[model samples]
Target: MATFATSDQLLVIIDPAARQTDGESVRIVKDVLSAGAAAKVCLPEGPEEFARALGRRGSRRPVVVGDDRALVRAVTLLHRHRELAGCALSVVPVGSTLALAQSLGVPTSAVAAARTVLDGVERRLDLLVDDSDGVVLGALDIPPAPVRAAAVAEPVSAASGRPWLRTTYRSLVRTLAPRPPRLAAVPAPGPCRLRVEVDGATVVDLDQPVEAVSVTPGSSGAAEVEVRPLSVGAEATPLRASGRTVTVVGGDFRYRADALVSGPVRRRTWTVSEAAWALTLPAHP
Candidate 1:
């Protein structure tokens, strides 16, 4: 059984942009979390500063006091440092943009989110790592979408600076349409051939152009490879498969994986190693 560290300190990293939107709620969360345990708060000037802050994250339990992108940024930073294993993490949903927290089943209310610190359960989940060495603790693959500045997604990291526009747009649209698991399919100008092999055995090979491909790697050389076909205004659908090694080939086009974009590469692959990371949740649901 996993045990919580009794002396672990909750290190709160606030998103500067979110601060403008939820500063009071953030302070309330910080003060609540600081009741007994030590709380250290820092405002990320932007994405780069956010990465530097997390890179220097010491032995403290990371407690992000922002929205999902903030959580993604910290998780990416931790995965980049290969510290996802050593560090246990927490998040407070202090923004109107709360899709990430909802996906993880974290509460949206500041008080409820803070109570997660005491009652949340630890769940070991797969972290998606790509061939280019991108570390994503959340969704890894997204179909292509019209190029909107961070308007569609935000990188798990904040390098391009926190995606305030993405956050705002997401919030507005979510209220109007609410984020549906079923997302309209982005147009695919051409076909993408995906050749998938596991343990040296071919699983899926196609010449049809796919709208998008997402790869999520588990810590144990296992991953979920999803292939979404390009259909006009198609809804989001998951193509789920688990494997030791997954490779995507033959696409002279670009696509979005969560919050970032990778160019028209010939192919890409992912290898999941045997180390698991956990998220704070009641169940791995």
Candidate 2:
């Protein structure tokens, strides 16, 4: 339902750090946008360098050429600048593990993804902000220990995984990686009570001792909160919720705040806040 004028300009911002990791692909990105030549492109130093670039972005539909982290950074910048509410955000994902791009329906190959940028559609999706001031969308996973190799020598470790997975890489990395994200709140076998209030309901009482608790707040306050006992192979996908605040109770625990990895403390309690931030996504492809 959102539209940008063909006459309007476009600005491209590529994360410099992303460039180092995928230099060739970054060149491809520049070439594709340069193929347009006339569209304005803004290159920032990194996630931290985006603010000044933020001040200069005009009314043109913004195009991002990088991985999920870069995408998140740009969107967060626009949201903070109050530009997301009105603009159509686009991404030409350049990373091998660009899962969120697939979720957004952008092509994976730099060239094809660029074509999507050339002819794209717009969608208004939800943005997630954690209690520790982290902003994200697509996923916030709390994984168990990485699945170790069975003593057999393999050509690749999860850390060294090829960027060749295309659309299936994210799920693959999530499944095969030996080391996964940790939970700040959940300790080992020792059980601790956690309080959970979803949509303001005391759904999880203090009587339950859980291996860990996960809460995700969705758009409009629809929330899903869950707690599971810890077992050697036990796992839980990040739960979804849409409450303003989720207060946990019981023994002290810490939690990861998005990609920063687990770092929250509950002096027997934790509060999770959910809200959407402005994000510019690809418009046509």
Candidate 3:
């Protein structure tokens, strides 16, 4: 376990996505933080610069002003460097995507989040670390959701005369015409023959196919594993277990860990590091 002391000095790193998405919110957060503490802000253009800025944070408490991805990136970098144990991170969520931040109890509003960064308490949190050195802050799901293909727009040639007229005609036709409903006949994904094990005990074998599997860091210093097996007719009861480690093996499978999708490997294992990191949240009443 590691200990942390609250400090008035801060090293604030504003992510580029946050700035591009909402500059006004970023400015407001910066203003509030600077007014409340001795803050040194850095605007990193890319991931490399972001990592560099965080790597050299010194003793000042590190505060991230971005979305969930930025917060995860900071935690992953710190965890990779083995410095996460001693650091208490703060986040001022400023992006369109912030489900993870909201799930973790961080304020969604810019001013409230900035105020939490200054006056909140440090709460130790659990983490899920995989065999390939990947970190999952929130949840992990097997067989990630399939991405929908984007519609391609028709190209207009410059040589064609009155392209605007053609475009307007097509737009008007599309708006006024009552087209027949075209239903897509997409099939649902089949079950996977995965072997799941929890702390060395086999929960499910390869013979049984499974609909889905999920793993999450539990508050009790362990991971919660749930496996939903596929049945012929009725719904199969989900197998649940809690342990320090969880392992899954089968054919190539993809998984979504937090916001990112990863893996198509045969085997993977994740272990829970109890109280692995700390996050700043609103003080308890």
Give the lDDT of residue 49 in candidate 2.
Answer: 62
lDDT (Cα, tens digit) per residue for candidate 3, span 174-269: 899798566575455568999999999999999999999999999867999999999779878999999999999999988988878897889999
lDDT of model 3, residue 91: 97
Which is the winner by lDDT between candidate 1 and candidate 2? 1
lDDT of 2 by residue, 1-285 (tens): 334456345777776756756778878777876665347767777555666765576656677777777777766676666666676677888754477767756678888877666665555555555454455555443322222332422333464555655336567755888974553554333555666665466755666545666554455534445656444465644333445555565544545433334433553222322334333334633
Root-mean-square deviation per candidate: 10.1, 9.5, 8.2
lDDT digits (tens) for residues 165-279 of candidate 1: 6687667766887554655655544546666555556545675446566665544557766676655675656456778776666645455555556677777666675445666
- Local lDDT at 42 for model 2: 74
| lDDT score of residue 275 within candidate 2 | 38
Give the residue spans of candidate 2 off by over 4 A.
1-8, 130-133, 141-193, 212-221, 224-226, 229-252, 256-258, 267-285
lDDT of 3: 0.89
Query: What would you estimate as the lDDT of candidate 2?
Result: 0.58
Instruction: Rank by TM-score, highest first.
Output: 3, 1, 2
Highest lDDT scorer: 3
Ranking the candidates on lDDT from highest down gives 3, 1, 2
Clashing pairs in 3: none
Winner of 2 and 3 under TM-score: 3
